[model samples]
Target: MFLGSYFVLSICYNLYLSFFRNSKYYPDPITHLVAKQSEALVDGFGYNAQILPHHAELSMKLIVNQVYLARIIEGCNAISIMILFASFVLSFFGRLKLSLLYILAGLVLIYAMNIIRIAVLAIGIYKFPQHTVFLHSIIFPLIIYGTVFLLWVAWVRIYAKKQNS
Candidate 1:
C-alpha cells in the first residue's frame, strides 16, 4: 500500500516537474545563479564558454562543442535531490512524520556533495579535456548515485531499526 502511493506520488510529481515547473529542471534559484556565475567566472578567467540548457537550473555548462557538462553533478540540483530523497523516503521509509525530516536532511547533504562533485569535474575537465565525456557521464553519475545509494542504505539501517525498536 505504501509502495503504491509512493509510486503514484512520485510519478505525479515528476509529471508536474516535466510540465508545470521550469522544464529545464534548474533545481533551485541558487544553483541556477551559481551555474551562471560560474560560467561568467570561467569566461572572465579567459576560458571561452557559455551556459547550456541543463537538467536542473544552473547545473550545466556548454563549451566549444556545445557539450553540456553538469556544473554540479554531485547533486547540487536541489529539487532533483529533494525529489529523489523524498522518493527514497516514501518508497523505503514509508509514510511517517520523521521520514520527511530525514528527507530534508538528506537533500542538504546531497546538495553539498553535488557542489563538491561539480567543482572536481570542472577542474578535471579543464585539466584533461579529453576525458570530459568519461567524467561527465560515467564517472560523475556513478559518484552522485553511489553517494545517494549509501545514504539510502544508512537511512534504512538506522531509521528503520529505530522505528522498529
Candidate 2:
C-alpha cells in the first residue's frame, strides 16, 4: 500500500510539474504561491522582500533589499514531501478516517513550516552570506525533514491503532 500510494502520488505530482513547466503559468502555481507566501512572511518580519519570476528557470527569485537571496523552485513547495508523508501515514496502522485527517494536518504543518523555512533562509542568506551553504544545505532541510520525522513518530507511537490478538 505504501509503495503503491507513493508511486501514484509521485507520478501525479511529476505530471503536474511537467504540465506546469510548459504551460502559460509563470514559474508554476505552487512555486509562485510558496514564493509569494514567503515574501509576505519575510516582509512581516520587517525585511524588504520581493519575488520575481526568473526568466531562465521555472522558479521565482527571492530578492531581499535588492539582493538576490534565493530561488524558490518547485521543489521548495513541499508537495513531494507531503506525498511521501501521506504514503507513510496511509500505510501505517491507523484508521482510515483518522489517518487521513492526520495526513491532512501534517501536510498543512509542513507546508507552513516550508514557507517559514524559506523566509528564514532568505533572511539568513541576506544577513550572513557566508553561512548560506550551511543554512541552505543543512539547517533548513533538517527543519523540514525533522517535521516529517516527528509527524511519522507521532503517527506510529501516538496515533496508530494497536492490533488485537
Candidate 3:
C-alpha cells in the first residue's frame, strides 16, 4: 500500500509540475511560494535576501547580499518529501480521521522545517562559502529527511499504544 500510494502521488505531482511548465504560474505556484517564504525568512535573519523568478529555467534564484546561493527549485519545495511521509502514515492505516490529521500536521512541520532549512542554508553558504558542500548536501538534507524519520518512529510508537490497550 505504501509503495502504490507513493508511486501514484509522485506521478500526480510530476504531472502537475509538467502542466505548470507551459502555463502562467511561474515555475508552478508551490515552488514560487516556497521561495518567497524562504526569502522572507532570510530577510528576518537580516541578510538582505532577494528571490527572483527565472521563468525560463522554471526556478527561483535565491540571492543573498547579491550572491547567488542556490536555486529554489520544485524539488526544494518539499512536496515530494511530504508525499513520502504521507504515504507511510497512511500505510499504517489507523483511524481515518487520525491519519488524515497526522498527515496534515506532519506536512506542516516539514514545510516549516524546509523554510528554515533554506534560510539557514542560505546564511551558511553566505557566511561560510568554504563549507557549502557539507552544509547543503549533508546537513540540510538530513534536517528534512531526519524529521520524516522521527515522525515515522513516533507514529509507529503511537500505534503500539493502541495495540497495548
Candidate 4:
C-alpha cells in the first residue's frame, strides 16, 4: 500500500510539474531556486557564479568566472529524494505528530544540504576543473545519498523503534 501510494503520488506530482508548473524559461521552480541560491552562495565566497537558463524547462548552466561549471536540472533539486525519504518515513510511521515533525525536519535538512552541495560542487569544479566529473558523478551523490541513508538510520533507531516498543 505504501509503495503503491508513493509511486502514484510521485508520478502525479512529476506529471503536474512537467505540464503545469514548468516553463520553457525555467523547467522547475524549485530547481531554479536551488540554482539561484547556489549561485548566490558561490558568489558570496567571492566567485563570479551565474545561473543561465537553458532551453529545457529543467536545465540551467552554472557559470563560474565565465566558465561553465555545472548544469543543474530538476533532478538535482532534491525534491524527488525528499519524496522518497518521506515515503519511507510514512511507511514506517510512528506517532502521527512525531512522524510529521521528523519528516519536516528531514526535508529541511536535505534541502539545506543539497544547496550547500551545489555550492561546493560549483566551487570545486571552478577550482579544480579536471575533477569536475568526479565531483559531479561521485562525491556530490555520496554526500546527498549518504545524508539520506544516515537520516533513515536515525529515523529507524529513534522513532521507528519507539513504535515497536
Global local distance difference test of model 3: 0.91
TM-score of model 2 vs. true structure:
0.94
TM-score, one value per model = 0.61, 0.94, 0.95, 0.91
lDDT of 3 by residue, 1-165 (tens): 899999999999989988888665568888888999999999999989999987568788999999988898889999999999999987887878888888899999999999999999999999999999999889999999999999999999886787678
Best by TM-score: 3
Better of 1 and 3 by lDDT: 3
Candidates 1 and 2 compared by TM-score, better number: 2
Q: Residues 1-165, candidate 4: write the lDDT tens digits.
A: 569758976997678676745464476778888989999999999999999987654489999999987799878999888888888888888888998999999999999999999999999988998998999999999989998999999998977569678
lDDT of 1 by residue, 1-165 (tens): 445755776686567545534534464445565566556555655566576655444245545225444454223454555566667666676457777777777877776666556655665687688998998888877777887888889888876787688
What is the Cα-based TM-score of model 1? 0.61
Alpha-carbon lDDT of model 4: 0.87
Which portions of model 2 miss their true places by more than 4 Å?
Answer: 159-161
Residue runs of model 3 more than 4 Å from their true location after superposition: none
Tell me the number of clashing residue pairs for each predicted model: 6, 0, 0, 2
